[model samples]
Target: MTLVVFLLVPRLHLLDLAGPAQAFSTAADLGHGYELRYVAEHEEVPTAQGVPLRASVQWPALTADDLVIVPGWRGRFAAHARLSKATRAALVAHHASGGTVASVCAGAYALAQAGLLDGRRSTTHHALQDELAARYPATRVQRDVLYVVDDRVVTSAGIASGIDLALHLIAVRHGAADAAKVAREMVVYARRNGDEPQRSAMLRHRGHLSDTVHRAQDLIDARFADRLPLAEIAAACDVSPRTLTRLFSAATGMTPLRYQQTLRLERAENLIAHGSTVDAAARSTGFDDARMLRRLRSRLP
Candidate 1:
């Protein structure tokens, strides 16, 4: 079982802690072999939401495959709040042993305190980005992104973005399909990429609130590499293919078939970047031959 240990601090943001936890828990429910655990310096932890939570002061045994996450806490002055020497040592030791460490929102402060961010790319809640950079010049603090992952250290923008980070980690360790399943279970329409400039074709047109369109997108995401039929997708959403196409176009400025093709093209590009031949990538992404793939590639806009 993979252990996910949450390092709790006083006055932490509730969603920053809970969002990722829920994602992993849902993945566990989907039989992902994930086991969630919590640790805190104090057994009684106070949250920004006025709810007092209890956690074990004792940490569980950890392996490199396990993860330690520090959720963002409530304070812009986190750089000044000193973590215990033991805590810093533990963070350093864990990472040195090849375990992954993640931070959410202002939680990047904790990782910085541990000296883990030195010479590494990371980010935090946009509100804390300037402060984090001012405090630690060695750490590269990025802006305008959901999250940044450098080596085994992952840092996310802010609260809800934690869910994005969690889904990303899931996709990396498992596969896109497993992450998609967890997102589907959570009712998250998409598993956003960490570096989303919000430009990826899969993410670009998901801004609308049409349930029928969303259901169509879900089906397309799950089976984008297949010869997906619009009739089948529309039937799944209980709409006629014509109605589905109109709704999808109205919501996303793209038809359902266009969206599916974009997904396939994106995956095909990734495959080719990873050294797959054009024909191999074409076959892998469900294209009949390289000719169609090449035609689509040449039309990149």
Candidate 2:
């Protein structure tokens, strides 16, 4: 398949372009056929980092291919963010002809602007979640997911998550084995499926809480794998178990046990993703016993 990626200049994140390009390049190197091209509004354009690249085709001259990608944009937080009309029209025409459209991070903003995201559930960098929802009210913005594939439109969270998204596309478009090979060359795990909840620290929503509670929560986070019990946590907070429970619940909107479980689960998922065996993951997350971790995961989803 041919992959024509539109990398808008002065606003595209490097890895958002590199990750998918590397995946597809690896695919072609392994004897599969793939035509890859980096395109822009003009032949030569500068990236956010001031690196200039000459694209194979200009935006106005781009013809449809198997896939069209809009990598994460630079100047994403600007008040008057918008894509050029030509680029928007090209994307609309490409998608209308049944081509796949994908975006990494704030690249979804371009798709949302093009009216392609209408009624589709998607995600971007967590900071932009509210902006996406406000601008494209027709779209359902998913804040906690790593990525979403609504029909042919694939949207992913943040920069590194773009790699995960591309790996998924490679797996689905080619096969699992091909995607695995690409991951091996990149020294990363196989792409996580879209339904996985995002584990990025940047995604958490903050809240107002007492200084004591915040301090207690910080200590808990720092010592998450210490196998600290409820009584220990309460004592650390200089409070009784009953008082600690009430305070923790009021501040975080979850029970202390639930919050700890969430932390453990997020750590376990990270370990699993980083190539740890399930047993190792359980052990690292303070689940010394295999069956205990299995039971916990079974309750998750």
Candidate 3:
């Protein structure tokens, strides 16, 4: 099992901790063997929202397969708000020992203080990018990106970008399919990859709150590789075929069958990229033959 340790600083932003924590926790729920731990400079720390968080003051032994993350905090520019010397040393030692180190939002300051970001490409919240660059001249600060992964050190933009960072980690350690599963369970409409446009079919047709459409989507999500009849799909969602079609279209801008086809095409393309033959990819993705796959490919610009 891989150990994921979160190093919480005082006045931590709630979402900076919760978003990534929830992603990893959901991955565990989905049967990934991950062990999560939380640590801090003190036994009890206060959050930016005025809530007290309890954590261990002691650090745990970590290995190369382990991950250590620093969630962002408020008052990043305050002298008293800085990470303790012990915490900085811990982060430096972890990275030197080949363990992965990550930071969310202003937490990048902690990693920089540990000398982890020196001569490395990193990023912080857009509003603090200039400050981070000015403070750490050796670090290359990337702007307007969701997150950056350079070497084994990861850093993300502010607030909700932590979720994207965590999901990207899942994709790296597990697979894209596993990441997509976690994002779907979290109801995340889109998983942004740096500054790239939306690419994952699992996230493409999302961003609405229709229970009927969601029910239908759940069916397709779970059984995308199987041949599901429209009537059966409609029945599972407790609606007629026509009603299901209309609702699905209204919510996702695509018919149920089209959605299924998109899922199949995307999966098949992944398979093909990984060296699967057209016929094999077709069979794996529920297509009758390579003809349909070829036709779909031809239609793409």
Question: Which model scores highest in TM-score?
Answer: 1
Kindly provide the TM-score of model 3 when superposed on the true structure, using C-alpha atoms: 0.70
Query: What value does the lDDT take at residue 112 in candidate 1?
Result: 94
Tell me the spans in candidate 3 whose CA falls farther than 4 Å from its real position.
190-205, 208-301
TM-score of each: 0.79, 0.61, 0.70
lDDT of 1 by residue, 168-235 (tens): 77766654556767776787665444446423455556666899997888788778878888899999
Clashes of 1: 0
- Span of ten consecutive residues with least summed lDDT in model 3: 190-199
Off by over 4 Å in 1: 79-81, 187-205, 229-243, 261-301
TM-score of 1: 0.79
Per-residue lDDT for 1-301 in model 2, tens only?
Answer: 5765655655477887887878778888987777786777667766677677778556433344477888886654453246689778878888888777889888888888888999898899988889888888999998767788786788988887887777667655543445555665786643343445543221131244466565566556556567778888888889988888888778667766666666666667656644678899788777768787788878866
Regions more than 4 Å wrong, model 2: 56-65, 77-81, 190-301
Q: What does candidate 3's lDDT look like per residue over 163-209, in tens digits?
A: 87887777666545677789988989744444442245666566678
Q: lDDT per model, in order?
A: 0.84, 0.70, 0.84
